[model samples]
Target chain A: MDDKLPGTLPGSRRPGRGPRQAQEIYRATLELLGGGGYDALTVEAVAARSGVNKTTIYRWWPDKDALLGAAIVQSSLLRFDVPDTGTLRGDLSGLVHRLVGLMTGEATSGVVVAALAAVAGRPSLAWLAREFVTDRLAGERAVFDRAVERGELSGSVDPALVLDLLAGAVWSRVMLRQAPVPDDFADEVVKVVLEGCAVRA
Target chain B: MDDKLPGTLPGSRRPGRGPRQAQEIYRATLELLGGGGYDALTVEAVAARSGVNKTTIYRWWPDKDALLGAAIVQSSLLRFDVPDTGTLRGDLSGLVHRLVGLMTGEATSGVVVAALAAVAGRPSLAWLAREFVTDRLAGERAVFDRAVERGELSGSVDPALVLDLLAGAVWSRVMLRQAPVPDDFADEVVKVVLEGCAVRA
Candidate 1:
C-alpha cells in the first residue's frame, strides 16, 4: 500500500526500521500538528506518540522543522494524481474540484490548516511551504503541457500564473475566507481562465 | 491622520480616552502580533506597550479575539482606496498591483502574516478573517459595478470570484511560495481575467 503512494521522500527509511515504522512517525507528526499546531510540536512528542525511540528519531531528522517537513511531504494529505482529461477545461475543473475537497475535507483540513498556520507563523518552515507548492505546481504543469501540445492553449500561456490563479481562488475561499464554496464555482473559474488564455486566431 | 483613516470601529472611543488612545492600543496590538504572533499576544502586553489600562481594554473588547478583531479592522495596513479607472482592466490592474505591494511590503507584511496565522490556527478568530475579506471585497465591488455600468464587463460576472482570483494569485506568491513578484505579473493576470469575463458581443 505504501509503495503505491506517490513521492515518498528518498532515503526516509533507515537501516533497521522498515517503511511501516517511518509511516508511524509521519502519522504521529501530522496528528500533533493538527491537534496542537507547529509551536507545540516537538520531536519528543512525536516519539512518544509513535512509540519510536527519541534517540532514533533524532538521528534520522535533525529537528522539529525537518521532521515536520518530511512528514508533510510524505503524508497522503498532500498527494494527488495529476488529472488527464483531454482538455485544459476538463482537467482544471476536475483538479479544482478535488482541491476544494482536499482543502475542506474533515479528515484532512486540520492538517492543511495546521500546515498553513506553520507556514505563515514560522519563518524556518517557510522553505517547506515553498517546496510543497513548487512540487505540486510541477506536477500540475503536466496538464498545461498536454493542453499546449493539443493546441488548446497557447505555448506562451504562463502555466504558473494560470495554476496560481486557479489554486489561489480556492485557497482564498477555503483558507482565508473560510466560506462555503458555492457549487459550480470551480467550473466558472476554469471557464473564465480558459477563455482568458484562449489562443486568438 | 486618525480622522483620515477609514473604518474606525464605532464605540471604540471611551468617555475618558480619545481616538488617539484607541490608535495607540491598535498600534500596540499590531506590533505585538508582528513581533510575537497571536499566541504570544496578551491584553497585558498591549496595556504595557500602549500605556492603556488592561481594565479599559477589557471593558471595550471582552476578550483577546475581540481586541484583535478591532485592531485588524482599524489598522491602516488593511486599508486601501477602491480604484476607479473607468475600465475593468485598468481598475483591476491597479488593484492587483497594489495587492502585490501590500502583501509583500516590508512595513505591512508581518502584520499580514500574523493575521493569517491567527486566522488559520485559531478557529475562534476565523470570523475576523472572514469579516476582513468581506469588508475588503465590499469596498472593491465598486470597481466591478463601474465596469458593468460602462459595459466593460458582463453584468453576470461574479465580483467575488474575480477579486479572489486576483488577490489569491498575489497571496499564493507572496504568502505561500514567498516567490518574487515579477514587474508585469499583475497586468498579465488582470488582462487574462478581464478577457475571461468580457461581455460576449
Candidate 2:
C-alpha cells in the first residue's frame, strides 16, 4: 500500500524524540485503518490519538497514502516470510495455507480488500502498489528463480509471469471478494501450472 | 461479459433496428474507448463517431459505463474459446497462454489496469466486476468440476478458488503493468498447479 497522503513532513532523527513518539503514531494509524477504511485514515487523527504533534507525524511520512502504506507494511498482522522446503510444491502449499489463515483470520482479508479497492481509485496509490508488490514478490520470486538456476526446471520459463499469474488470481479473489481462496486451491494452482499436464498432441 | 446494454429501446424492444446498426453503435463505443480510455467513453460521442442517432445509442445502453462494458465484451478482438483436447493440462495450459496473449497484445493492459484503478472511484463500476468475472469463470468451472467427478483428482478442492488464484495472478500483473505474460509461463502455471504437486509432497 502506497502512502495515500502526499504532503508529509520528514521526521526527526534526533535521539530522544524518536522511538516512543513514532511508535504511538504508527499504532494510532493502524487503529484508524482497522476501525475505519483507508479513506478515513487521517494524519490529524493519528496525531490526536497518539498525542504526538502533527509535525512529528508529517516528519515521518510524506503523505496520508504513504503513512497508511507504511503502517500496513510495518504491520505485524499480515506480515509473512515465504517458506522454502526445497521444492516449489511444498513451499507454496505451506504458503497458501498460511495465506488462507491470514485472509480468513485476524488479518481481516475483507477489510484489506476494501481498502485496496479504495486505493485502486487513486492514481497516487501506484506508488503503494510498487512498494508492496516489490517487497512481497521478493520471497515468492526467490524460490522460483533458485529452482530454475539449479536446472530443476526448464531455463526457458520466465518465473516472473509464473509468480504473478498465480498470485494475481489470489489477489483478485481477495479484492474482488467474489470467492474465498479455499484451503486446497493454492496447491492446485501450484500443481497444474507447474507440471504441464497437457501432453501435446 | 454480460451485455450491460440490452440493445433495446428504453421501454421496449425495437423490432425495426437490425444488426448493422447494432454493430455500428458497438463499433463507435469501442472507438471512443480506444481514443479516450473509460472516462471519455460517452454515449453522445459514440453516436457522433458512428453516425448513429444518440437516441439509438441510449435506447440500447442505460449509461456510458454499460455501453463501455458492452463494447469490450462484444468486440471480436481478443476472442477465445475453451479447447478440451480431453486433458486438464491442455485445457489449463491453453487458457493461461491465451490469457497471457490477450493481456500482452492489448497494450491496453495499462488502460485496463488504469481502468480497474479508475473504477475504484465509481461505485457503479465496482459492482460490475462480478458481471465480468462470472462470465469468464463459467466455462472454466464446468471443465474443472467435471474433472473432479471423473476421479482425475480430489473432489474436495474448490474449483472457484483454483480459477481465482490462477486468474488473479495473471490480472494483477497486467493491471499493475509489473510484467508481461510470456508464452512459456503458461507451462509452469499449468503443470505445478494441476497435479496437486504440493499436496503430494
Candidate 3:
C-alpha cells in the first residue's frame, strides 16, 4: 500500500503539488537546453518560458545544476527502463532497443548533443553526466549479474565493457549519422558481441 | 624512384614553404579551439596570434572550416599510420592503440570535443567530421579486407559495424573517463569483439 502512494515514490514530485506544472517546467527546460545548450541556459528563462515562478523551481531544485539534473531525468533523454529477460541475449536486445530509441529521437538527441558540448566547456557538468551515465549503466549491469549466476557468462566478463560496446555502437552511429540504425541493428550488435565476429578454432 | 620525390610524400609540408610557419599557424589554431570553441574561433585572431598575414590564411583556406580541417590534420589528431599486421587481431589492436592515444592526448582531445559541440550549432562542421571519420574507417576497412582474403574473417562480416564497435568503446571510455586506457586496453577490446564474452556451446 505504501508503494502505491505517489508520496512514497523515489523520484516523483511532491504528492500535493500538481504534476502539470512540473511537466511544463521539464518541457521548457528541454526546449531551452535544445536551443541554447547548458552554458546559455538560465533559470529565469525557464521560468518565463514555462510560466512557472522562479521560486517554484528553486523550491524543487536548489541550484541550476540540480535543476538541470532533474530536467534531464524528467526529459525523455533517460526514459528507458531496463528489462530483465531470462537469457543474456534477450536482455541485451531489450536494452539496445531502448537505447536506440532514446538516442535517435530528434528532440532528445538535440539536448544530448548540447549537453555533451556543455560538458567540454564546464567541468562541473562532467559530474552531472557521470552521475547520469553511472545510473543508466548500473541498471544495464544487472542483466550480466543474472547471466553470471546462471552460468551463461564467464565469471571474468566485465559488465561495464559489455555496456560500453553496446551503447557506444549505437551512440557512434547516431552521432555520425553515416547510416541509419536499421531494424536489425540491436540484434546484430548483440549477436556479434555475444557470438564473436571472428571465426575461431 | 618515381615515389622517392619529396613532392610525393604523404604528410609532407608544401614545397618551397618552411615547416616552421605552418607549425606556428597550426599551433595558434589549436590554442584558439582549446580556449574557445569553434564559434568563438576566427581567422583574424589566428593570424594575429600566429603572426601570419590574414591574407595568407585566406589564400590558403577560403573559409574557417577549411582552416580547421587542415589544422586538425596538421595537429597530429589523425597521425596513426594504419598497421598491416598479418593477423586481423593484430591489425585491429594496432588501430585501437593509435586511436586511444589520439583521443587521450590533451591537445587533440580538447579540439575534438570542441568540434563536437560546434557541430550542434554549425552543420558544416558535421560534414568535416564525417569526412575525417570516413577516411579513418576506410583505412581500418582495408585491414579487415586483408583478413577476409586470408580466410581469417568470414566474408559476411560488416566492416563498418566492426569499426563502429571498436571506436565506440574507446570513445565512451575516453569521454566518460571512467578508467584510463590501460596498456592492453586495445587488445582487450579487440579480443572481446572478436571472441564472444559468453561461453560457447
Which parts of model 3 are misplaced by more than 4 Å?
A: A1-23, A74-77, B1-24, B73-77
Q: Please, what are the lDDT tens digits per residue for candidate 2 over residues A119-146?
A: 5545456566566666666656777666
Q: Name the regions of candidate 2 deviating beyond 4 angstroms.
A: A1-52, A63-69, A80-94, A97-111, A114-127, A137-166, A180-201, B1-51, B81-91, B118-127, B138-162, B180-183, B195-201
In model 2, what is the error at residue B70, expressed in angstroms?
A: 3.1
The window of 10 residues in a row where model 3 chain B has the poorest summed lDDT is B3-12
Give the clashing pairs for model 1. none
| Fnat per model, in the order shown | 0.60, 0.39, 0.57
* Candidates arranged by lDDT, highest first: 1, 3, 2
For model 1 chain A, where is the 10-residue window of minimal lDDT?
A1-10
lDDT of each: 0.79, 0.60, 0.73
- Residues A1-201 of candidate 3 have per-residue lDDT tens digits of 343312122233444444457777877887888787776688899999999999888777666776676666555445777788899999999998987877667767777777666765665566666666666766677898899998889989878788778877887777753358889999998988998899786
Question: Highest DockQ among the candidates is held by which one?
Answer: 3
Maximum-lDDT candidate: 1
Kindly report the TM-score of the first chain in candidate 2: 0.76
- What is the Å distance of residue A83 in model 3 from its true position? 3.0
RMSD of each: 4.2, 7.2, 4.8
Docking class of 2: acceptable
